[model samples]
Target chain A: MLTKRIIPCLDIDKGRVVKGVNFINIKDAGDPTELAEFYNSEVADELVFLDITATHEGRKTLIDVVKKVSSVVFIPLTVGGGIRTINDMRIMLEAGADKVSLNSSAIKNSAIITDCSKEFGAQCVVSAIDVKKEGDDWIVYTHGGRNKTNINALEWVKNVEELGAGEILLTSMDKDGSNNGYDNELLEKVNNIVNIPVIASGGAGSLKHLYEALKFGKADAILAASICHFGILSIKEVKNYLIKNKINIRL
Target chain B: MPDISILNTKSANFHSVKKAIDLYNKQNIITSDINEINNSKGLIIPGVSSTDTVMQNIKDLNLEKIILDFYSSGKPILCICVGMQILFENSEEGVKPGLGIIEGSVKKIPKLKNKFKVPHMGWNQLELVKESEIFKGISTNTNFYFVHSYFCDPLDEEIIIGKTNYSIQMCAAIQKNNLLAVQFHPEKSGKDGLKIYENFNKMIS
Candidate 1:
């Protein structure tokens, strides 16, 4: 049977892990490669490195960081943030990233999703949609979840899947950083509408929350950042909990 | 010093395979050179890309004949994902013919009654059917990273060494003499994945 994936997300800036990871056992908390190695030992199914770096030089640093991290860790890696063009996706894939997540660029020029998927297989393209609930409907947000778009979240997900995106990385802006849980309502609706895999992102506070996303929301994977970064929960612990709950998790 | 050569299909990600081999202190060369591949102790056909494109690239580079030549040499050759798909005679994904090294056909994963996704993406466990050197250190039912819509259905069931279930039991790995092919990406499958490469490295050595 296919196992549910547990992913640890890292925010990288200028080749350094920006999020203040306060794990005492970690010798270098800022080193992205070191953190990735830690996750590997913890049995993380996958890793997502969100490049929070803004400048061109930072992008270059992120690429180098990707190469370095991929060389050290053997698991699948997904890189997102500031990936604007096909060339950017190519560079990241060549640097050993298994998948590239496109957010704002995909919204601005949806053709990029088709083109990238055509050049590289649809499996390489990940359509990342950031949404916030409004008036009983979820609205898509861009520009790092600050600016809102007129496009409806459910509709955009359907469009991306049709556009050849292999998977959907759905993040709820309202639930993001809230430590509450995933927006199960949004996840349930989107999962029902799309045929591709949906990765639930943002607001993963506990093991039960991750379970809810997979059980109620029907997410194929869960992306957690704050909980893992602050040493509150390890990937192994989460997998164990999921296993005990009869969830088919990769342990 | 054993030399492992990764065939450069132009579309495949050879770096991850190379890196995996590098961890075991073995040297891997990424090349389209027929002579280099023929001379290596082992050859790895990595994944990523459609079957048609990969076949066309191999034919264009004239590496297809060399691959067969290497296989005849009886030195181990490992094919991964799309690489595994092309080992068969034909595929539902492309019009081009496969290398025909293995008697099988690549078909799209059939949709289940419950509607499991087409591209069986993410981590999945391998159900070993028979013992093989490729999975020497890896335990049974160990999860490996997979991302594909099509799967290989071998005409010879005896060749199958591993199977995985998405909606149904699919052939995940096969072994026919010196030729070993898997539908999963060992290089992207974490520690257990690396163990596969390590086992392969030991086999060739």
Candidate 2:
């Protein structure tokens, strides 16, 4: 049986961890490699380095980060944020990143999805969608949640998958950082529509919420940040809780 | 002489495999040169792509003869994921014929009413059916990272050493003399996964 993955997402800016997170007992909390090694020890299925760096130098630093971390951390590593072109993706993939998450670029040019998928295979392409509930359904938001698009969340997910995205990283903007819980309804709907894996992000306040996302929402994986970053709960504790509840976690 | 030559399959990713092997012995080199690979004590063909793409690259690089020559020379070869699939005669995912080093066919994972994803992309347990030097310290039912849609249906069931369950009871690892191949990526399987590389290195020494 394929075990449900528990992933910890690290926000990176210019190759440094964004938040003052002290989750791991490393000397440098901002160091991406150290945090990655710590998480790998904690049995994190995979690690996500969301590079928010805008400058070219910062992106170069990200490549170095990927190289250093991948050399030590022998788990699947995903680098996202600021990946706009095939060249950007090739640079990261060549540097040892197993996968690259496409957010804004995927929306702006839907062809990039097919191009990346064809050039690098679908498994290497992750379609990240940021959404906020409006009226009866959710709407897609780009530019790091600043620009609103008229695209419907459910419809866009299907489109990306059809365009050859291996998986969908659905983050509910309404629930993100809210600590309320994941949008199980939205997750279930997306899961129902597509056959690919769907990673539930946003509002994971408790272990029960994680359980709900996988069990009720039928999510294949969970992308968590604040819960693990702020030291609210350790990954081991989350695994223990998930195991006790009969969840198939990598133990 | 190079300890091991990681075959450049041009499958988009193999550095993780190289880095994993580096922990045990840094003498490995990722190369496409036939002479270097032929001189190495061991060979690892790591791949992550469709059968068609990997096969196309393998054909373009003209690696079939060298791989077959190395196999016949009794130098241990480790094939991973699509690398493992390429050993068979053909695959359902693509039109290109495989190297046919191993007599078998690669079949697509059935949807089964969409109970599981096409690409079995995650950590799954390995049930060892037979002992091999590759899994020296690894235990049965150990989890390993796997990412592929088509599973190899080798005609010789006796060669299978490991089995993992996803859509059905499928072949995960196989051993035929000095050749060892696995559908799962031990490089991305973390600590336990690293043991496989260590064991392979020890086999070389």
Per-prediction DockQ: 0.86, 0.84
User: Clashes in model 1: which pairs?
Assistant: none
RMSD versus native structure for model 1: 1.2
Chain B TM-score for each model?
0.97, 0.98
User: Which residue ranges in model 2 land beyond 4 Å of their true spot?
Assistant: none
How far is B192's C-alpha from truth in model 2 (Å)? 1.3
Q: What lDDT score goes with residue A134 in model 1? A: 95
**Per-candidate TM-score against the hidden true structure:** 0.98, 0.98
Predicted candidate 2 versus true structure: per-residue lDDT over B98-172, tens digit per residue? 999889999988888888987789999999999898998889999999988889989999999999999899999
List model 1 lDDT by residue over B1-205, tens digit each: 3388988999988888889989875677899886777778999999788999999999899988898889999999999999999999999999999999999899998877647997999889899999999999788998899999999999999999999998889999999999999999999998888888888888888
Kindly give the number of clashing pairs for every candidate: 0, 0
DockQ, 0 to 1 scale, candidate 2: 0.84
